[model samples]
Target: MNRNPHGEIEEIEEEYNYVDAPAWTVDKVAAPQDQRSLFFTQSFPLIAVCWLILLVIMGLRIHFTSESNAKLTAENQQLEILMHLNSTLLAAHENLGRYCNNLTVQFDLLTQNCTVLESKIKDLTAVNQQLTADVQNLTTRSLQLETQRNNLTKQIQNMETNWNKLNVSRAQWSIDAYCPRENNARLCKACQEGWRLNQSTCYVVHDAVSTSGHKTWEEAREVCRRESSDFVIVHNQEEQYALNYYSWFSTLTTGYWIGLRAEGWRWKWIDGSDLTVSHWTPQLPPAADGQCVMSVQNVGWRSVSCAEKKRWICKKKALYV
Candidate 1:
């Protein structure tokens, strides 16, 4: 032990010397717990600690990435559903537009048909009114024509009555050339409506007859009414005037028979006329057998037996006027 100057003890190392040998290595395997190994023994614990921290961080990242992938798949399915719904809505709108167009065209045709029917009804009403007016006019004209026809018939009947009054003779009378009668020259035909013109006298025989098929005087008159329009009658004294120039018969001895009869001196004409005058010779109607006669001397009536043989003077008329 050695001490310093301040009285401390001092120790001393003995001098030992080691010798350098030649290099020779032994073949040996290293063990895991060898602390003195120079290649990896000191850093083994640090490497294990670092590998455990990296495992922890990698586990956390794997969990987060799995969650993100599931969320993305759900969003893609939702977008596809929305696209299908939009396409269906667009197709429905196009179908509805086509149906509305068809309905509008049908409504226009119905309106046009109604207007044509109204015009046809107006034309038919006008034609019906015109026909009614024409029918009324024709009925009024027919009534007026009937009234005029009735008035004309009355005038014609009056003229016929005046003309017939001059055709029948009552007695023998003579007139000179002053008055011209109707027919005296020619023998008249059956229905001599006009007379034969001559110098002094004008006469006509419209018809003459010797009647029979009679039972009584009254029945004979009725039968004559069916066959002739006028009964036997005489008109005036001068109507019995003889035809002088161109007579049909030529016997100057006897006068013609006029329609005259007597009942108890109550003188009557055959057509029921009053005895206004007479052309009787002296001593007429002496007895009951001398009541009727035929003209004998072309002068006047004379009494004779009713059965005497003499030609009866037939004429167009036999009734006294």
Candidate 2:
């Protein structure tokens, strides 16, 4: 038996020849048909129940498969979005790295420039210091030169004044002293006819040829004063030596009266200065009131009484031409 597409059951009949059979075979066939019919009747409800259980299992499988396909599609779309975001982030990072590199280069250049400027400033400072020192040295030198110039100017002024006075003195001396002597007419020498010139001074030695020519120290000094001079004043070693050389000696005891004399127990010159230097003889006696100084040839000075008679020397400034 079969079910058609229209939902109706149909049976196919087989053409069989009728033949006589023995009773036992017939009984055997009939019993088998009854048993098969009983078995179909008993299993029909259980077969329906099994078919229902199988249909339910197939429907659940199809539903679970559809849900799994939807979940897989959503996961693929999310993965694509994540890949796009990663690409954009990579591009931004690259740009930032390039900008950082440029900034670093600019910073390095600025640092180098600053270093060069600092070196230049230091060099300028050193040059300035050297210039300042040079200026100070120049200032000091200039001040010293100024002081020297001032001193030289004063000296020149003094010399000019002295020269003028000397000219006036010379003119007066030429009229008063040189013009009156007939032997020295038209021949103006440094000394007069009877005087001897030693450097800038004129000296005259009066030696006594007779006893009348000899004079006491006071008398000798008065004679020099009348001649417009004074007794020979030994102011230095050279003058002393010259006097010793010029004085004529007839005996070892002979000495000339000088201008030095004792005043109030101290030796004084005719110029009123105290005796700071002396050429006294080794045997000179102690000085007292009325003691006077005299010079001996090849010897030294001696203290003698003012009343003693002796030769004398006179000294006066020479006339300038």
**TM-scores for the candidates:** 0.26, 0.44
- How far off is residue 250 in model 1, in Å? 29
lDDT of 2 by residue, 145-255 (tens): 899899889988988998899789867776756545566666567787788999999999998777689999999999999878998877788888887876777344568
Worst 10 residues of 1 by lDDT: 9-18
Candidate 1 lDDT by residue in tens digits, 1-321? 122443211111111111122234112212212423542555567677777777777776777667676677667677677677767767776777777777777777777877787787788778778777877877777777677777767766766675555333211111212122447643323222443433332333322223232122333334444433222333455533432122223233222233455556665666677556555665445434234443434445554443332233223331211
Winning model by TM-score: 2
TM-score of 2: 0.44
What's the CA error at residue 100 for candidate 1, in Å? 1.9
Q: Which stretches of candidate 1 lie over 4 Å from their true place?
A: 1-78, 121-321
Off by over 4 Å in 2: 1-185
